[model samples]
Target: MKKVYTISEVASLLGKSKETLRRWDKSGKLCALREPMSNYRYYKKEQLSFFEEFNNHQIQDSIDIKPQGDYNVLELFAGAGGLAIGLEQAGLKCAALNEIDHWAAETLRFNRPHWNVLEGDIREISFSGLRGKVDVVTGGFPCQAFSYAGKKLGLQDARGTLFYEFARAVQETSPAICIGENVRGLLNHDGGKTLKGMISILDEIGYRVIDPKVLKAIYYKVPQKRERLILVGVRKDIEIDFEYPQPTKATYTLKDALKKGELFNEDVPLSPGAKYPVSKKKILELVPPGGYWRDLPLDLQKEYMQKSFFLGGGKTGIARRISWDEPSLTLTCSPAQKQTERCHPEETRPFTVREYARIQTFPDNWKFAGPVSSQYKQIGNAVPVNLAKAIGESIVKFLNEKRLIEQSEKSLIAI
Candidate 1:
């Protein structure tokens, strides 16, 4: 069992003043236990379990997600290793990972010493060597259009586009299935013509494309209501049906994202973070919880918004302060971007570095490497690790079922 600590001890661990800790208590950011007689604040031993996802052994076991037998994977465009870690937790062993950014590649290597992280351009790598051994090929491929130069676009025409690279990998690796994730906007990009072309491209490579679906992350126990469009494909030879993971009934809130709770075992750890300039800080203090700049005084709203104040409808993200009681707004790459701001509910500033990682469901101890701004970009671009874990579990189940069918077929053939 873990040792319980006093409020001061926890505060010391978090690097905040006792007064700020009390403020967090009042705001329900951190919950405290009261001693029966003195009514003094303290935390329980059980709280630590929520701060860290895996046990003292940082290597999260696959059995927790009910992983099937050993399964291996090759991932492309793997950023910050959020999805890869999640998949690893879900029982898939990563054979190799391709990440273009140097910082992100370093971040991956820093976290998992054993991972084979390929740090360079995707176009230069040949995946043909991995053809039969890899069970899955996954990527969050950037959405780019293949010119309808011939109207009926095929593998040859998609060569220059990122999706072409992704398809090329699929063709080379010959994995049982290929998983591609993208922004929800892809559903309607170029009036849905782009998606249609993507499907046609998959068909050209001898794979059957499933109708793509946009998954709302909140449903899978993530606090934020972010969405991603998941595109799945099966080799033309297989008749297996894929199943998506079922969502948990409970909905996590922003409070859950940042502090100690089921999502994390400890109050978030202190890390280097950015601070807002005095001018921006002063303006943000006026915004209330769950409120934006428009929630401020009329004159201040116009002053803060400038000429754009008169331009359009509710740009809710403007000068927006998140509510502790509610889910956070979808996070942007820059936490304090002027147009798509995410103000700390009570404090007149942006979320700190550790706070941003919490919102993305990264484990507290999973240190990020790079400058503060670069760290923010990496976290913002990652798929919430929890969401990826859920997807991984679902894929594992499908593969297990496929494995069983193959076994049964072998038995019948022998008979």
Candidate 2:
């Protein structure tokens, strides 16, 4: 997992000659970074499109695990039911979903009337009634720092945080397995103490926590280059191992997301979208496809970026225009936000609502219930539907194995 590569190393990795790379750099096809002290040209691991190894895992055939019998999932912090939809598609039933947001809850109830959408604060809800009925418990809890006391952090130390609620639900429901998902930054939050604390808390609650994994959405049929850190725990009594859904060899791009292609059967439906202010629009119009603030002319770059222009590190997301051939950068809670602009390749405006849904792999028919800004937040914060389905399939596989083991043990006892 090297983050920066020398030109020669990149040439070897991409199976290209140094001369060709130099030409591509000069042509702006594959930009190379220059070392500040040595001025030596290098390539960032992400800039090399042909190198799939940067995903940091072996690509395997897609998984197709089916449930052995009816399996039920109890979802928490279930914003708009993205995970629930995916799990349902993978043959698991959604027994209940608790979302604190009124709009997200309304969206879930609107789409799936049968779903038990519990709207309100998670802290006020109780899962003890469904203790043994739920096969799995899933939540995308917000990451927060826990007060440290000893070598191991306990559940009580995480009180007042959303994660505590998630852990509490897991303890109360007593499911065969539990899952927690969060942004990739969670791995390093609080200099890694936050994740370690979570692991220790799960361990204390009669569950064996697995090493967390950051699954890239691009490898799981998602058109956007999003990543989610997945934390999985198995109840101590279950001996079955849970494998992450294997990454697929296939890749997708913005074109696949918005046009009639493999990712979608029809072009993205027409819908309302955010428009850049005239001043921002003027600057972005100068940027070509796949280009960012650096692509702008010197004066415009300075004007558009302001103080950030003088800052270190590549502010590549600013004024970015996504290329049709590339997967979009991870979306934020707001598309029109200056820090992470997601401009359409050809259009000067932001992606429309339906287009945003398509990029997240939501079914075209699935509707959001909220104001335009609220809708964007729901979609942006969601686990991409296709990626969630992949995870769900893996969970189903684990449960299938557990079911078989339990059945065999019962038969042996009878004999």
Candidate 3:
């Protein structure tokens, strides 16, 4: 492994601009070293230890950590089994999975024949029988606005939203812990009122909601720069604490995901992928690896961008081609969409279905039971499997601690 990295290499690795690195150097935040002969700025690999995703042996060891016992999870809104599969990988057994999408439910049942999959609207399902039987209740509830009837947001305030169904499940199951995941924007949705409402609802149901956190997928061995905001609630009656999973210091890149490297044993299997129109393909051919619409020639940029060319913000996702060396940008439901084009690094085409699954850390044998577009949507919307596994391990550790504490109390009472 190389001990030193050039300015450009460091910038790419850290996902920062060269100008930002120079600013950091000036401020002594992440100072670069001067090469003795050339005086060019360079960074030592050791210096990168400050970043949570720095490549390190300790990080690799952490990734090998596993759960202490067999915990059970009841998943809601379990689209395509990304979180369910991840928890299984971390040693948790799935009690049941509920998904509204028929194709997604079929995908789950097709991949894991033994999983109890319930397909329908969440509002119609009753989890009363699962009370005290399930260890955890997990969901990726869609963010929706709650009716502000009073100063305090109550359960009824969220009645029409998907989050209401998630909260209802948690109340019905009365699990030791409940986890709800959403997009990062949820933190500030409706000016942060939506999340506050959720926290209040969980509190009313006797679960103490932890301060929500956004886990970056790249820090958890996922080969994409995706982010998911995780909300954890522990039963207030349980005298135990729940901690979010610690991020690993090692990061995987597109190469690890698509090629035979640390993340996979074999190269990505080829499958059907979305294609760009002839006119769009010609425009993307000009964009190099790591390049976007802004990299095109002046006339072509204007022609391709049209009104977007004059837009203020950097529309970086337009005509973007992923680089093999870096983690891929967060995937969208449709790879060929004009707003969120995820073009291949070497080819003018979008990533194949298998490649999409690979980026999301799905195992090679796990197949999606749906059309190509549906498969892409499922993979794109999923919480990266590696990230979910890391979280599952943390939940297991918490459950073990709770069990030990209960055992100690029981022995004292016996004495």
Candidate with top TM-score is 3
Q: Candidate 3 — which residues are off by over 4 angstroms?
A: 1-4, 7-9, 16-60, 63-68
Candidate 3, 28-101: lDDT as tens digits: 89999997998988889889978744553245336444555667899999998889988898888999899989
For each of the candidates, the C-alpha root-mean-square deviation to the true structure, in angstroms, is 10.3, 5.8, 2.9
The global C-alpha lDDT for each of the candidates, from Candidate 1 onward, is 0.79, 0.87, 0.87
* Tens-place lDDT digits, model 2, residues 272-391: 999899988888899888778888889988887789999886766778898887778788888898758999999899998998999899999999998999999999999999999999
Model 2 compared with the native: what TM-score? 0.88
Name the lDDT of candidate 1: 0.79
Ranking by lDDT: 2, 3, 1
Cα TM-score of candidate 3: 0.91
Question: Which of the two candidates, 1 or 3, achieves a greater lDDT against the reference?
Answer: 3
Model 2 regions lying over 4 Å from their true place: 1-60
Model 3 per-residue lDDT at 347? 87
**lDDT at 138 for candidate 3?**
98
Q: For model 2, where is the 10-residue window of minimal lDDT?
A: 11-20
Residue-wise C-alpha lDDT for candidate 1, range 1-415, written one tens digit per residue? 3367686445323323344556778898777878899998887766645542212212222334465577878999998987898888788989899999888999999999899998999999998988887888999999886577656778787778899988998899888888899999999998887788888889999899888988767666677767889999988888887776665645567788888898888787777767777878878888888777767899988888999899966677778788776667778888877778888777777888888888888887677888889899998998888889888887888788878888899999999
